[model samples]
Target chain A: MGGLTVMQALAAKLPGERFLYLGDTARLPYGTKSADTVRRYALQAAHALTDHGVKLVVIACNTASVGLPYLQEALAPMPVIGVIEPGAAAALAVAPNGPIGVIATEGTVKGGAYVRAIHAHSTAPVVQQACPLFVPMAEEGLTDGPIAEAVAHRYLDPLMARLPKPKVLVLGCTHYPALKGVITRVVGPEVTLVDSAAITANAVERLLDEKGLRATEKPGEHHFYCTDAPDRFARVGEIFFGNPIDPGAVEQVDLQ
Target chain B: MGGLTVMQALAAKLPGERFLYLGDTARLPYGTKSADTVRRYALQAAHALTDHGVKLVVIACNTASVGLPYLQEALAPMPVIGVIEPGAAAALAVAPNGPIGVIATEGTVKGGAYVRAIHAHSTAPVVQQACPLFVPMAEEGLTDGPIAEAVAHRYLDPLMARLPKPKVLVLGCTHYPALKGVITRVVGPEVTLVDSAAITANAVERLLDEKGLRATEKPGEHHFYCTDAPDRFARVGEIFFGNPIDPGAVEQVDLQ
Candidate 1:
């Protein structure tokens, strides 16, 4: 899910920076696994990305973010930034005085990455809620309608009632933004919702610029790789990127 | 999480089935991955299960149920059933007219397996809510307490207000029964909450009996395998199974 959106944003923002988006289609969705399991899969993905000549790696998935410490250790030499810190930093910056709500996958919420990161920089309390179903819906392109609205209410109602009602809500997982509309409505118009992808993309842009790793040369060729059916990846990637990605651009890579 | 439940349930009901529970610890959360990705991981897990000489296979995860058609085709010749059909069947039988609420991972909700299954058998209204965070909480042993209660209230309150209220609430995911107490309290006592494992076990027992596949000798033994760290699996499994599961019994499987 993060694979699709991050690539879309990158294409729009850094038109000249070559991007390689790999979906571990064979073993996608690391959010439900244990921390150890997430770390292993993340390392494998990082290795593949690095081998593809990615100067900087973005751990777009929140589950992967929780294991960024392990990924950083393995993917050292290349600068690696996870979606959590950038997001946490952004949430804090936006609502320094109010509570911040973080919605993510079960694994990410349990790891307490956002909570810790948010708490580290500011005294603003962090309220973490894991909306596990959001990923599947986003992936399935079921982000709108009564079903989506019902789900948004089911997840956001309780979080909205908490003391002071969080002014800033963090879309912790990469797949979450797809459900942002329904989520925003459920949480109400007053609360500010944060999508990590946007923040993370901005952070990536800054990191690349500061480190002199920004690709300034070509028209930025984009490559999409999945561990499973390449065609399916392209189909789903197209939905995520909000544009038709050429099937030819998507190919399969053996994660095993 | 299902690993521990399988082990405990096996220890009690069918000890003769020598246990080998693979955690897929490496690729733990099959729920968030795409249908194609889930099918591939589930197939890998089934291979491990068949390799262990198990006559029957249970795709314990709810997400797998949405993709059961694919799994049924892949694990052919061997009788394999996912938690969805049995669970949906159970809910339908109890509440032919009453509304049904389903809680599951994001993937399961997106698949609409429960809704389709229920609609196919009965006219009962189905309200499927995705409690994406529940899996991680249960795995983290945050099954009870202020934090868990708060989380459950946040997720269930909206579902509670949905309609005339559901008579039966299906705990669509295997990890959900752990949160039953809080879920029941939040949703209210009027609704009967369903646990997929119990329903699946009942279904499994019936199938085994009908086919004369029940272990007629000693009790069945369960072996748990995860693709991640054994210690982490065992620790989380122990919390959910309500017993001290020997960490040594959990062997890590390599997805690569």
Candidate 2:
């Protein structure tokens, strides 16, 4: 479902580029699962995309992004990108000095992908917090009320209280964007929020331009696929995608 | 993870019965998946349990309970029980009159298993509200405090305003038991809360006694298995199970 947000970003950035989205809804929420399990599922999903003959594969999900290296190795010669690097670079571009905050799911935080990615470029102090409830809250569409604000405060107050204070707060998880309103209020006005979806879209656009792989077509069609619950995906997915998902366009597929 | 609560209930009721528990942690939160996908996973899990030579099978999950009949048919002649029926029976036993309420995940509520199960015995009015956020809240250990109370009010206030007003509220999902305190406060003292875990345990106990299948052994061993993240299963699982899980006892298995 979070991938829908990235897909929308990609669509906005490169209008003529086609997209084939595969949501592992059946075994969703790779966020809380083990790294090994997430890696295996990510590989399987990437394989499905590779079989579809796409020019590049963007792992829109931050948790799944932890397996980018393994995915790049497994699908040799094919260009693959994950949200973490672009997000990390984007955060550093705005706040190159020190104290960057990252809020993602448990798996993403545990994987330390964002922290490592940021450190690879700069020695800025990175603070990470896992907001497990944000995904469900976002999905439930309780974006800004008392409950959302309360939960956000609970997760972010400590992160905000850290020494030096974070100038940039990375919305590392795609789902986090939905709760942006409450998150902004919780983090206050000083923090510049970085949305990985848009930044990753920018990264993909740059890569495509550099590689001369930009689409020449006037427009492109969007194809949606999931492992299960096409109806719910097409419905709730509209919240993330910011567009109505045609029920007929959503197809269900099984992955080994 | 919710199944762990049910497992704890079963262990309490049948101390002499050995158990083989499987947590489909890799593809958990079945609450949101389609019935077909959940049914397929349930069948696979049941097959794994059947191979272990268990005398009876209990579908501890309310969402997976939607496939109880199919599971019972698939594993014919093997006694099978689902939480929904037992939960509904218990709800009716307490509130024989009309206007009973049920709170569960989206899939479980959409399945209308509780409504059908309750109506199977009487013509009572079954009001159901899908509390999708409760599962994550419970898992995150935010079962109390202002946030919990706020979320409970958000979900329950509408149900409480119903025409007849539900006299008995059934906690249809296993994860719900953890939020019993907040939920009790929300529904007030006038409403009776039916815990599916305890009721299902009683049903299983009765079935075992009637069939002369109660274990003669003095004590029983509990084996915990999951598709992924044994460490997490032992850690977060303690919140649901109400007991510290042995890290060494947790084993990871693969499901087809």
Candidate 3:
């Protein structure tokens, strides 16, 4: 579902580029599953996208971004961009010297993809917390309220309380953007919030320019695909997509 | 997984019954998925369980229970027991007269399984509320807190305030039991809370007894199987299982 947010960002940035977005709604919340399982699913998803004649693949999901190397290798000759690198770069650009905070799903935090990406550029003191409840809260439309606030406080207060308190906080999970209001309130105004969607979109544009694969057309059409529940995906997906999704337009594909 | 809760209740009620519990961790939270997708997944899971030489199949999940008829037909001759019927029956047993409040995931509530099941027995008015956040709250160990209370109040308060004022509140989803404390506080003491796990367990016992399939052994061994992340399942499953899950004992199997 968060991938919808990334797709929205990419559409906004590269208006000429046609987008074929795949939401594996059936085996979703990859953050809770194992790395091997996620990798296998990611490969399947990549293959689905490739089969559709997609020019480049964007691993919009933070958990799936951990398998960037595998996806890149498997989808070789076809460019693959993951959210972690762009998010890490954006966070470092904002706060290169000192502390950075990252909040994502358990799998992403445990995989340490953001941590590794951040370290690759600059050695910043990173404090990572896994706010597992945020996904459900975001999906349930509890993005703002007492429940959201309390949950945010519980997850963020600890990270913010650390020594040399984080100068920049990276919203590692795509769903985090939906809860941006509550997250912003909890993290306060001083800390910079890094959203991977916009940065990843920018990265995609740069990649297109470098590879000379940029579409020459003016405006491009967007097609949505999901492994299951195309109707529900189109309905609930509006939250992350930031646009109205025509239920009839969404196609159901079987990756298996 | 909520199925683990059903497994726990079954273990407690029928000590002599050998149990084979399968947690579809890879493609979980069937509540949010489409009916067709859930049915397909449920069939796959049922096939996996039947392949293990299990005598009977229990669709412990509330969402999956919507496909009980389909499963029963597919796995014919192998008796299938779904949680919805037993839970609805138990709710009716306590309050045979008027209103019943059913709280479950979106899929279950949308499917109207509990309502149909209850109406099948009596003319009781059923109000169903979908508490999408409870599953994550339970899994995240925020079962009893201000956050939990707020979420419960947000979900239950409306259902409780409806005309006729439900005399009984049914915890349709297995995960709801973990938040029983908060739910009790919200719904008040007058409303009797009905948990599907225990009721379903009793149904299983009665079915075994009637069919002469009850084991003669004194104590039965419990084997846990999951589609993915055996280690994480073992670690986090304690909240639902109410017992320490041995990581080494939990085998990972491929249902596909």
Which model, 1 or 3, shows the larger lDDT?
A: 3
Better candidate by TM-score, 1 or 2: 2
Residue A152 in model 1: lDDT: 79
Candidate 3: tens digits of C-alpha lDDT, residues A183-208: 89988999999999999999999999
How many backbone clashes can be found in candidate 3? 0
What order do you get sorting by lDDT, best first? Answer: 2, 3, 1
Q: What lDDT does candidate 1 reach at residue A56?
A: 86
Model 2 per-residue lDDT tens digits across residues A75-156 = 9889999999999999999899769999999999999999899999899999999999999888888898788888899999
Tell me which residue pairs clash in candidate 2.
Answer: none
True contacts kept of each: 0.27, 0.90, 0.88
Off by over 4 Å in 1: B1-17, B23-216, B219-221, B229-251
TM-scores, all candidates, are 0.67, 0.98, 0.98
Error of 3 at B229 (Å): 1.3
Point out where model 3 deviates above 4 Å. A218-220, B218-220
On lDDT, the candidate that comes out on top is 2
Model 2 regions lying over 4 Å from their true place:
A218-220, B218-220
TM-score of 3: 0.98
